[model samples]
Target chain A: MPHDHHDHLSPSGHPYRPDQDGPLTYWQAMEIAIRELMVEKGIVTAAQVREQIDAMDARSPAQGAAFVARFWTDPAFRDLALRDGSNACAEMGFEVGPMRLIALENTSRLHNVVVCTLCSCYPRNLLGLPPDWYKSRAYRSRTVREPRKVLAEFGTILPEGVELRVHDSTADMRYIVVPRRPDGTDGWQPDRLAKLVTRDSMIGVAEALPATEAPA
Target chain B: MADFAPGARVRVKAMMPPGHVRTPGYLRGRVGEVERVLGPFPNPEQLAYRRKGDPLDLYRVRFPLGDLWDRDDADTLEAEIYAHWLEPA
Candidate 1:
């Protein structure tokens, strides 16, 4: 009676996601039939299919945090990361796969912004998933040529003195911004430093640590 | 060069299936003439392993910027090309 969203689970066991494609409502017999048919035809093995789905669910955000950690304590490594993004990702136990990725470092003087100018070429291997706003058409079109305007739209006001360079990441590669370390974290270990690299900071939508509060 | 040459229409395809398709929804079901064709290039979606196939032929098909947005409201009449994925349309 209270505008129930999960009405499908009321009578049946299956949880119904309100937002699903197609005209059909929840509990589509067609989906089950198609899967069963595929299984019967041996188009894909059950275990193989299960494992693939499991792999998607198994993804963790720690992969990105680990990447942030390595860049904090090591300057030489940071240099390499800015030079070759894929190598740095590998050093942090992540892979960009066959598609190449680029790493951008946002400093006090320079702001490196990333956008899938064409589409959403996110670094899901490391970042897990892209945030909703990253996928918006507003972000894709405006970020490339009018970066300052777009960043401002995201509530990030780049200082007039600071130069904003937008990186247009396509499908083949990704660009990650190595955020700067906070000021108070003197003599901090890499693990501790990594904690400061918030996802927003890495995206250049927000500045890195050294603000009034450390990143959550 | 003229904005578009004759007999040079191209059918562009979507690079990604879901989430944020690079192809704007407005461009879908629309056809335009091929303004210019670049060399064969690798498909970004396929390279990401999100989609599969070989490199595709990309074209810089011109659509008036105003046409993409709103004809009356768009600031400049400057022409912009959307990345044209090869197709029969």
Candidate 2:
């Protein structure tokens, strides 16, 4: 489909003169020109183009970290997280709305899990923005096909006896992998737990950092 | 397609359209190789913007570590890139 140029460019690029263009950088002019031409000819409407742009422009959820902390404190809530993942968050006063959230827990059965076979479908509400590498094609294609090799690059080479399951997220729904808090963080409070469930854990790329280790 | 093969060198024009779904911001106008050409794809990016119905041509570009970014990410491994051509390369 012939889309507007502004859509493909990422947040890294900002306009040269923000005072006039609202800090919007001309990341790529060719794609944008192609899109504007199509719109000018009535092939597509500006309203329709904006609709998709709006979805991309959606903000990260506010309550995500709080919910992760809630589950960390309540063993019962953690079990609920294992069951229907969204309900667990909702019970703790967080909602995903139309978007879905999948929970990948590190358990005895499996040590780690992650998403992205084709594209990046992260848990925006729980996790803030995705890392730059997540948006890169290297991470997108390698994570699912070679989870072990890719995980190692992230400094997470698994030990013997741990099984890795890679998940592929579609355009619909978001996913979060609850990293089992490290051994040192036993008596930590919910606030501390919130700190533990870093964005990497939510992406299933890196496990949550212990209270001792800094948030990834 | 002169001497064009998978893993050959190419660079994208430093231009973007208004409603396109493209590679992330950090990867514009960078040079890389044609890792694997995915042929034509149903462009989810253009569709996401509610754009036209024309299918996109996909190419998997492989770039060396020293080329894309300079970091201690890993000395051994290489980076892979993916993009769909809007017109001809």
**Model 1 Cα lDDT, one tens digit per residue, B52-85:** 6455544434333344454432221111233444
Clashes (N, CA, C under 3 Å) per candidate: 0, 27
lDDT of each: 0.61, 0.59
TM-score of each: 0.60, 0.52
- Which one is best on lDDT? 1
Report the poorest 10 consecutive residues by lDDT, candidate 1 chain B: B73-82
- Local accuracy of candidate 1 as per-residue lDDT tens digits, A1-216: 543675667445556567666677456788777778899999977887899888876775456667767777778877888667788877766766665556666677877776775668777777767887899988877765466677777778877777665555533456677666667887877776766677777777776556356555
What C-alpha lDDT, on a 0 to 100 scale, does residue A73 get in candidate 1? 72
Q: What does candidate 2's lDDT look like per residue over A67-141, in tens digits?
A: 767667888988888666777767766655656455666765565454554567667656655766888888877
Label model 2 with its docking quality class.
Answer: incorrect
lDDT of 2 by residue, B1-89 (tens): 22346756777556675654445433456666664444354566667767764554455454333444554222111222334432224
Worst 10 residues of 1 chain A by lDDT: A165-174
